[model samples]
Target: MSESAPTRPLLNLDALFDNPVFAGGFGLASLGAVLAFARRGAISTVGLIRRRMLVNVEISRQDPSYPWILAWLSQPREQTSFLARRLTRINKLSVTTTTSVTANGPTRASFFLQPGYGRHVIKYKHAYIVVSREKQATAKTNTGEPHETVELTTLYAHRHIFEDVFTEARALALQAHEGKTVVYSVRNFDWVPLGEPRRKRPLGSVILDEGVKERIVDDAKDFLARRQWYVDRGIPYRRGYLLYGPPGSGKSSFIQALAGELDFSVAMVNLSEIGVTDDKLAFLLTKLPERTILLLEDADSAFINRRKREADGYSGGTVTFSGLLNALDGLSAGEERIAFLTTNHIELLDPALIRPGRVDLMVHIGGATRYQAAQMWDRFYGDVDVDGAYRERFLKRLDELELFGEAKEGQPVTRTSTAAIQGLFLFNKNDMDGAISMAEGLIPPKLEAEQ
Candidate 1:
């Protein structure tokens, strides 16, 4: 033990530092740590500067401005292309199809390719705007469609620039909707476009009973014009109309045409939709877009007997009768909303749902009448039927077939619907004699149903 202690002196700490291998390793480790710390500090400083100097505008998918900005950014112009290149090498595009889908897949039609959720950069007139799209917590919707938003950041913090951007974006969006009617439906407690904007249907094309269309249109115009009257009277600035008649009696068609006539968009509501609860209905009604028409088709289906529905093995919806009534004019019924309810069987509807306030006007859009038929015929031939030769023969054929059904009382109501007559005309297209000849062959649909 004595010999071993003598041989091994003390380990010198100074010598260890002086050794080449140990010293070199220590120097490298120290340098690496310092560099890392310096880099991290630089990054933090840059982030802080950005936070202080830059401004950002957040556009939510729920806002109408979201689509407007999207449309603006999706433009295939020099700026968009340049931005696409400088932002990222990855080109993520979303396909918007106006084409119809089939079992074979999607058919070919005009479609727009918009940038997907990603970072984009655009050089504006005097500023560099950065657009960041994200599908974060807001992506979830009841319809399962993605809900996204864009954050527009720029070095310039002026409000005018953002306003200008939105102004231009709105103009672009309106251009897209010009001469068309955009229909909307509810999803995730918000209204969303159902499909592509449809070409505006001419009001003249819709054939209704004498003065029916005029009366409804006049009432709508008056309601729109008299907003201040309701306000002064301390009444809800809302109007409701009920169109009740047989199926294919031009209820939906007239509604669409009326929307075109009023230059308003259509927000179609289905009370019996799977997840449309009473609360949802009230919220939707309360938050309808300005200059929008809310239409409820098959309104009687939901108001009909629930037990009867269950007995028929048809599980309806969550909207109850009382809930619907309250949604119509309750505390939160909302003002400035024009609601249109259509039903094939009005008798099935509860009387409370169509009282004075709820359904201010109940227009009976009955089956095809002589006046309606004549107007439709004149529309097809236009001024070419000036001699009235074809028109007279058509009316004679209608009488012989007993299509009007206004004859003897015991006969089944054979008044053919405008839709049925239109179908026949479409089948014969511009051939008056041909349509008259075919009318005598097939039994009218209403007659068959009643018989």
Candidate 2:
């Protein structure tokens, strides 16, 4: 047999290269080895370590750093990175435009970047920022099904570079949210993420007594600035505010404005929601963002007749009064959290829940006052370049309603709510006289016939 043709090896080298998967994997491994050999010296050098940070979308309800990293990577002026090419495509793609209201108007639009791997350079900071998406397998479900989740992985040149990158990224996110106010409400008992922000009355636009505004804002600033003070005294760096007011007052509006003013995100919690157990509440409170303002609206409804529950020997509710108290006391709360408990009926709350340490500040948000009415009117119509005659006509009608005269300093005031006024304005948009007339008609008759 011609000595079996000299018995060439059974494995064919050419055939191995013909198989794409095998060839590709072999090529990658060879390249990795070569790189490792070439960079041996550089790897030995001190102070050149590559560091990585992971940001997840599920853990603690989507780490904020992930969005911050995206914002940093999407910088339009970054020319020397892979992200530049993708960003250019992103800008060119005809995507849906999301409009949000701001102090300026609803003209501002936000576009979310598509998720992918991108290389970016932080010029001033002298670092390479590489972002990648990582898919992980989650625990099996009750049906014995496997699930996959995606998270963001951010790699930087060094640990120190990560610090600078995060600082700048956070600033960028805050800038993007400027002049816009977001409202967050509890979802799934464990999620306190933000909802779509509506055009809200700014801090300056919402009318509260000058003293009240000053006290709340100044106190918040002081509290934020006093973190070290609290640590020094071994006190938990937490504070609470109680906003008790009738429905439609500036309670929620003021909170929204304060969130915008402070550049702090809001995370609202509703205690009465299903599945809100003590442990879940604690987890939610402790996992809130550091600079978040937690709003627990309708506290009375959440903890109705706590005293009665205790006296009647009943131990049932989605959340017990003790659980709420513990959550508010910062037992497992975030280090730098401020909470607001709002109610229309404060007396229905258990005294133990709103005691001195639990509620540091109590603010009563009554109906809108004269200054508020005038401010709302001016804010709504002052900017219009409408006919001077029509403007005067609207003002005369507004004055005729005398909504401004309902409240006076040091006197009991019966007034309409800012929400009621805003509703009237919305229904009669661009018709100033109609808004004023409808606003006047909103006051209910004093005596109602028995139903």
Candidate 3:
């Protein structure tokens, strides 16, 4: 049997007014007229009110005195009953509209209001947001007319997505002005792309075997904690990490993993490809976007054997040791900047660059541990559980071979030789499954493996 569809409810205007309570209420006839107008136009009461408000505002703008007369004529009883409240709301709305129009003139004025402080106007154009100090001055026009002019001096241009970072920086600047905090200004740095040959593989792609993943996570957590602590203390929250290890020890992979985990964009700067002098380098650093991870890969190669005072013909002129130092920790040092320097040889780096005040953390990634090797075996073989006896024998063999060290307590571990471990795992490709099972037994469980 077919069921009948339900009927929708309809508004009964007559019945609504027939009720003595509603009829006796104030402005009942006016309210009825409003409803009737809405029904005739197939519009809602909200739409009608909005249209009336806009019409009134337009009329008031054309004839500034018309609003008072219109209010008196349209709702004399309301004005008499709630004159103060109505006028207060109307005045606030008018002022708000006027301020909005003034602020959003020919050029948009970006302004934000802080609870305790006043409004701050942000000037944004192109890809930069200009932050400046606004000052009022009097100027004479060509016609000999005097007028007040607001002059703005550019303080900085922060890139997009770094707005929060800049906001914090601005707060820090304010505190510095009040002698409550130290202010560091970051130097401006430009990102110049190299016209080098493109590789067939995708840029910034890192592959991790199971064993190395765990270690990366642990180290990343530590890094994030340190960053948070700086933010909480309102300190210059910049971090400088040094990633050094063998060529194929997954140094780059670890970097990519960290960037991915932190959800920060990686801005890789190949120093060898940079043709800028010390002055330009300092500028680029100041202008780098906040909350960004700047990667200086192969830093050792860029400065290797180069004298600090040498005058190399570059785009920004001669670079000096003093200039380099100023560029790194100049007035424009921003708190949210994160810089990573990776090198194959740690010994090749200048002592100034690796100093405690320069790079905050120095992480040395060495060869893979035995735990890492076994984890890699399990990943490649897709077998978590292997024969216990065979695994023990294999582990003994690994210990005798000294393939990976035993996991120690209260000490930082290294998992460098990942490539070598991977190669070893694939050596017995014929019986890969059996080989993995045997290898797992030999690896110690105390050493944590990355996934």
Candidate 4:
């Protein structure tokens, strides 16, 4: 009797949505509750499956493995791959920066393709694998480039799949760079690859004065081999070579060959580059890539206006001289490094910059010598001057015209560069006589005037 009295206003469908026990807008409370429960159950079931039956991995753009994976996937159809060909179809594709010299002429730079930024699938060894690539701007590179992450998922039993995939990818990447030199340059405080790997320049190709190449190579090898010695002595494991002379004297070439000989990469840093400051320089020096030789080209010219830039209030991040010095030898100086500085005007460089700890070895990569000319001739003709006959005749004519530097008892000779000599040889590659006839161009202006 009491319950019947309380139900005087009978509940209807409209009453159900008036902020009832489970309030819902528009839809009735019962329908909304049912939908919510189903949605939650679906989410829970999916999560449980992911946790119990699936395995996953995440690779950030910062990781070296990231490129390995991308490179593996982006390989063209003509190339051989372990899993790339197994992918039956990938509708979503992205164009990448990598390129190849295809027979196609002057087309757009869409030579390379990879799975675009979305969900992708691959069939590897008869197992299904899912790839999800996502980009977020919450993090940025030095140049404000978008940061990305790739997530890979597969069955729980396929955990070893990642190791195998990455292993093969890394090997492929290394094989591409094998027997080639990787040149790096700084961009926005980070070292980036400068260009396609250069065909390795053989050490024998760079013909220096006798004992010069050997001495430099031996020192670098010895220094690299004696890491424990430097550590024990509490000395920073750093070595610097200052190669100073006129332009085209093989200063840069020798460094490249040296790097190739030592199986090392080269990082070229222009200290006076815009936006390069004391802090940035220090940061770059500290974070140099491993097994890389730091090459500071035109060191003298780069810093000549360091003070002038500051005084003029040039807002660009110009490097300070003090910053350069500190980066070379201060607390921020990197260990296990080989530094090469090439300058056409060594005399203009500050003495402080070439001090003991900073510039350990000062080598003059001067003009081509009689020894160099002869060796280069033999090499250019693809023959050995075993009898010294070709060298004698070639050098004899060079002396007659003062093409090679004049030999005097006490006077310093102004000689031509190996590059210049090689250029002349190439101009008359078929005719040694033609090369000799063109030898007058090789004479230094001072020698010509004095004669």
lDDT of 3 by residue, 104-148 (tens): 466433332221111222322322222121222443342333332
Which candidate tops TM-score? 4
On residues 173-217, what C-alpha lDDT tens digit does candidate 2 reach at each position?
777667666566666533434545555456887777547888999
3 or 4, greater by lDDT? 4
The CA lDDT at 125 in model 3 is 32
What lDDT score goes with residue 380 in model 2? 74
Off by over 4 Å in 1: 1-48, 79-92, 101-106, 137-147, 157-159, 186-190, 273-275, 305-318, 405-414, 441-451
Best by lDDT: 1
Whose TM-score is higher: candidate 2's or candidate 3's?
2
lDDT of 1: 0.80
Q: How close to the true structure is residue 92 of candidate 1, measured as C-alpha lDDT?
A: 75
Model 2: number of clashes?
Answer: 0
TM-score of each: 0.80, 0.64, 0.43, 0.81
lDDT of each: 0.80, 0.65, 0.49, 0.80
Q: Model 1 over residues 32-100: C-alpha lDDT tens digits?
A: 999999999999999899888888999988786887888888876454566555753427778777765
